[model samples]
Target: MTDAVRATPAARLRGIGHEFMEFFRDLTQRSPARFAILIYLSLILVFTGLFSLPFAAEDGRVTPFADAFFTAVSTICVTGLATVDMATHWSPFGHVLVFIGVQIGALGVLTLASILGLVISRRLGLRAKLIAAGDTNPLRTHGGPVNEGQTVQLGQIGGLLATVALSTLVIEAIIAVLLYPGLLIAGVEWHVALWEAPYYAAMSFTNTGFTPNPEGLVPFEHNYYFLTILMAGVFLGSIGFPVIYALRQHLFSVRKWSLHVKLTLITTIALFFAGGVVFLILEYDNLLTLGTQDAWDTTFQAFFLSAMTRSGGFAILDVGELNGSSLLVGCMLMFVGGGSASTAGGIKVTTLAVIALAVWSEAKGRQSNQVFGRRIPSDVLRVALSVVAWGATIVALSTIVITQLTKADLGRVLFDVISGFATVGLSTGLTAELPDPGIYVMAITIIMGRVGTVTLAAAVAASSRSQLYSLPVERPIVG
Candidate 1:
């Protein structure tokens, strides 16, 4: 301190810079969940500023800060609900800007930061691993307490990130190839076709509902090839990158899959097929939906809609035309969402599975939370319940706020609200017409959904004190 006081101005400035860097590292190292959340907020702000630029909009149109902010939120959150026409409202520069946001969002907020870290430092510090831990599920899976502070190794982190980035690019590239010729044959200009293919690929693979075309997916409604490619992308993307890596490493054997993988694969597939069957039964006679198509086409469209309901957001049939029962089903599916640590959002399939398992255990009077020949820890169960509880709270609060603002029907408001909270991007015709307050509310919902309930809870719980003494057990009356 004495030396610093005696030092020149340059030395003082250096000392200040060093102190700042250390503080930044400490902040990051302490709670990666909060750090990741910070990155998301910062990125959203940057994209909003970029969208606010006059050059980002159509030649004659000026996008208001609110609209620009909404679009930026949707893109960065990878929620496709749009306040305006993507193709007509945004200039190519704007589209590119949105695309960049989508790409980064789809890769994940922590993941993008880790990538940047690798570029700058050629290595990830312990802080980066803490953030990546949010995606990897180390604490529960490795049989540790909720407060376990284990960190993944640098090599494992590198491989995990490499698989995520490489797989995303490779899959998107392949889908783009499949979509290219169709775009050309559809009379799209060569330049536009070139962009649309990649755009659709990114959107689909990220499970984002955004479409590059003005008509949305309607023009390609009957195009099985187009829909198939998109469906495949969404399905694969919704399967977490961790699962994908496991599949890549051990596709030929069932033994290698972790319990988490097993549950996710089983639940995701069951949901997909069950959703298809339910829709087919419900919409079999509705002329506005599948009833208008020929028998074979109707079945395909029903299944396609089912796939999209898994947070993919690309709809061949108008969601608004579906029967009330189908709408209820859509809301349920959107709320359940895709896999853990996936670009797809919601409470996640694993959380749902855990809840169901817990229910079953209670019903059977089992002493342990058991599934897949293993005992799921108490911590996992607690986390799952917390996520579900928080998720429900968010959806309920958003529904009330949005309905109050828009004066929309309860059901329509519920659909849009849940869609925003789950980041499903599906709408019941209310998104484009939502008032400013409604839009702002939906934007906040998307952020919560994208950040995830568990992550948020963890960030808030960081300052909590550990119990040095256990409290006496007490039982409350059951429902």
Candidate 2:
């Protein structure tokens, strides 16, 4: 009887091992979402390890595990809330790890993984292609079968990814080289200046807002060239990859631009300019900018920097130095966030556009939504509403939780919460002082922002392919 029991257990163990292997094989073949999660987790682990090393700390001493883990999480999520001052705590090696994490996180786990798969396999499978399409929200593939045009368009997505990466690198390289001389002129040593230039370049373009210097640009506050490069990088990075790709295609084929592209471009330009003007007007006499010697230059700088602060997290002037009204405006901008499918987060420009269109339609008594001379699809509108609703819910919950946890003022708490949800990293100097519970709340917000509101909603929604039945159509009272 004992021998029979032992044999049965051994057989079960073998069977389980075989099933596990099959599961792994199937995952490699068909699971893009799972693959994305794994890639992100792996990168986070690597960052955590590197940051735990003694050289990664700014004091040239080994950092605590919690601090390192939190920093790695913040970097990987591209949420720039730092527990410790990056410049003063981390060495060169540590800074590089943070930079690499920011780049990878901003590109996204699925995108980078898909690129790798395409490179290694030389072609994407149908499952992979479908996942890619869903993630990017490409237009519906038409006709009874796939065509060359669809394939070309899909290929262009890859090309666009490469273009964005290359553009970012080249721009940063130029800025680094340009800034090196400026830093040297500012009395920085050649070695320190050279190291910091590239560091700033990487941080600025990625919108990670991590400064290699502890003072956080106070010394370069008046340097036009430095500010210009930083602002340019931030703006380019905030614009979505799809918009950039569309712009490139439009340059080649002027008449074939999509409405999505048109809407994104218009909204982005309007928001940027409008936000700049708002900041200029509100902060004109504030100590942050008005205290400067050059009035016009200060105004211009304030406007440009305010635009950057919305999604980039790089505060050229001290955020703490801003007055109450300026901080309120900054919080609003941060909450609205940047474009869809971009490194920057929030409810997304598309969501905002859809909401605006919905409001316009209601005001006009229109039965259908229209924008850019085309009717918006019902499914698109549903997704947009869901994203906005869920995003607001999460942010509100986070604000409440963080307020309770930290006992901070409601405005400051709300600002930090929105900043985390948008991944904007602009703080009212409250991030580091938050208790452990507050940190966790921010961490969750960071994850949600980076993973995306829609993605998270989908994950929580039904995953089954089959639907039971459709409910009877009924109009609910919504105002």
Candidate 3:
């Protein structure tokens, strides 16, 4: 007490600073994934506060922190779920803020931090590297050591970050250029088209369904060229960064691509066909969907719906009118989502593929799960199963909460809940009507899904327990 009383204010400030540093040091060394989660949470809070300011809304009124927080979460998650109208409710400043937020969220906060670190020191310290490594590569969690060869490969972190940024810029630019004429043709003035092109491109390339046009993508539904261009943007954006980077280095040389890249492409393509076929069959005779359209139009619309189900979230038709069978397909596609390290959110296609291959191998009583002529790592299989379990638990729990809160039908509630948890933003006209509790529940789900269910669970379950001895093995009876 005597020493504390004698301490000056300056000394006390220094003591607090040192303590803060120590806290962060321990966190980074002990649980890098938790550190990354903290980084993302900090960004979300900053953005939420900014969105709550007076000028964020068009009316110059201080936007309610709840709505603002929802928007901030949605934007930072790149989820495209909105309670307020994006075009009419937001001022240009707000729009710009959201644009910046989406871009930041697309690359992830830790990724941007890593790039900034590279700029500052030209080399990340071990702690910073651990944070960046865990965020970018799921296989390299802080609970375990990374492979030696992979650690050397991380020496090119700077280059990989640059490639990710450059690839996003180039893809968005191309898509924007291609979409400009469509906006003009859709009756937008030249000046409006100029801004709208980039907006659409950003939303599309990020697999977000936020359209600048009030009527949404419906106006261009019949314009095959416009829809096709959007489809292209969505597909490229959801393909994941590692696959894109591999393509940049290897081009058309499939032999040079990584096994993960190969698996992503194959799974993505197969799901595209499977999803489209399901939609085609379910919506064939339904007038609200493809019933009135000719075969050509039906085929294109079905394909577009299939793409949207893969987390693109852009819908040409009202999803609420679809049959129960079509909704089932939608849920499956949304849950299985796009590739890992992608802007698109879900359990990830790789996770689904690994689980499926593991099941197939077990069915045939094989020694190990094999894919692309390589055996899947045992740890990867464990992670895959863990992801599915976490994803299912969240979806089930969120669905129950949402249904209880909103009293919405189970079908629509399931659809919205999955959409929220997958960050897919496709809704059956129910999002805006949700009560405050419902909105908050969805906000949590979007954050959970965007941060990743498995990643979030891992951070929660983080431990330093390294067993020195193995437990006795036991086998349980199977079906």
Candidate 4:
């Protein structure tokens, strides 16, 4: 009896730990969307604490909670928007935190979790595969008949994870190698260039536009080769990992590419040129922007701005100085964001592609949405529609609240809101000036944008039901 009494406290502690493990395991299997969100929030809290440390700042003072929290959200979300001076506010320790935060963030919440699980167990379990698959394809998050053809298959989840890790390392290494010479030519010290090269590489590839230097991109503003390298890195990062995996297997064979790959590439290329043309036309004569440059410089800068607007976050031109029409164009581009499952955010280019295809089919009086020789089911269209609706609602509410708080111009407010919502990191000189309240709101916007509308919706859903019976259908008049 005395021994039992002495052991009771330890026994209870063990029991509690076991129960917590069981609950976590269940959460991973039952609702990975929620699990992913939980992990992401936990990361934000941890990073926020780290950022708030006295040594995190250059002056050895404790950073304010608001800036630290906002920076944490921005880093984890891979959103470049900063409430504080990203270049000058943090100490070397803080900069290291940003570096590590973005690398983890770029791996994505679910993927990072799965990688951790893989390391612990030394195998990829079925549940772990499903969780990682959820990152690549939202349909895997809930119970339903999923079109596995639309995304990475269960068998490929391991390869996808490998690709995620290997590709990030390889691409960033190549980009850094390419950037080192440019930084040297631009007069940076060799030691500084060594660090800055990879820093810029990660920032570009992750689509988090935080610059390591106080001057941002001003020093390399007219360096076409440097700017072009950044643009290439952004393009690779924004085009979703599934697309990359597919392309890796079928790079030379265009016929073997999946429909997702087809749409992503086509729409991304289309938007790249189209946005550049629009910006070129709108900002051609604005003295504060591209207007001061010669014809060649102006043309290249317009395209560079277009690339950055699509979630690259690196800006050679001052985003605030563009024409109002140009700002609206930026809003549209930022709203579309990058491809799904990529480090970039927004509604995703694939979502835009699906909606555009559905519209095209409807206009043509077709019974189904067909693209690249495959039929897109109604459910996919419905989810695409839901993403658009939710995304728009989030942006609208954020813009309204921030507008009321800041009393800023609608154009600037809308641009920054959309930028936050899309995780584009482009700012109209407003994000840095936001008050604490506005900073929190914008942080929330970045979270929503990064977690994605579909995944966020799934995370909050009470439960997924099979619905064994069909209800009576009624058609309603619509626009």
The prediction achieving the highest TM-score against the true structure is 4
Residues 61-151 of candidate 2 have per-residue lDDT tens digits of 8887667777887899787888778877887788788888887877765576577566545666666666565455433321123323322
C-alpha RMSD (angstroms) for model 3: 3.0
> How many angstroms is residue 394 displaced in model 4 relative to the true structure, after the best TM-score fit?
0.5
The lowest-lDDT stretch of 10 consecutive residues in candidate 4 is 138-147
Which pairs clash (backbone N, Cα, C closer than 3 Å) in model 2? 57-89, 57-90, 58-89, 58-90
RMSD values for the candidates in order, in angstroms, are 3.0, 4.3, 3.0, 2.1
Give a tens-digit lDDT track for model 3, residues 16-62. Answer: 99897766666655555566578778888999898888787788888
The best-first sequence of candidates by lDDT reads 4, 1, 3, 2
lDDT minimum window of 10 residues, candidate 2:
142-151
**lDDT of residue 434 for candidate 4:** 94
Question: lDDT scores for all predictions?
Answer: 0.83, 0.72, 0.81, 0.87
* Model 1, CA-based lDDT: 0.83
The 10-residue segment of model 3 with minimum total lDDT is 143-152
TM-score pick, better of 2 and 3: 3
TM-score of each: 0.93, 0.86, 0.91, 0.95
**Residue 193, model 4: Cα distance from true site in angstroms:** 0.3
Which of the predicted structures, 2 or 4, would earn the higher lDDT when compared with the native? 4
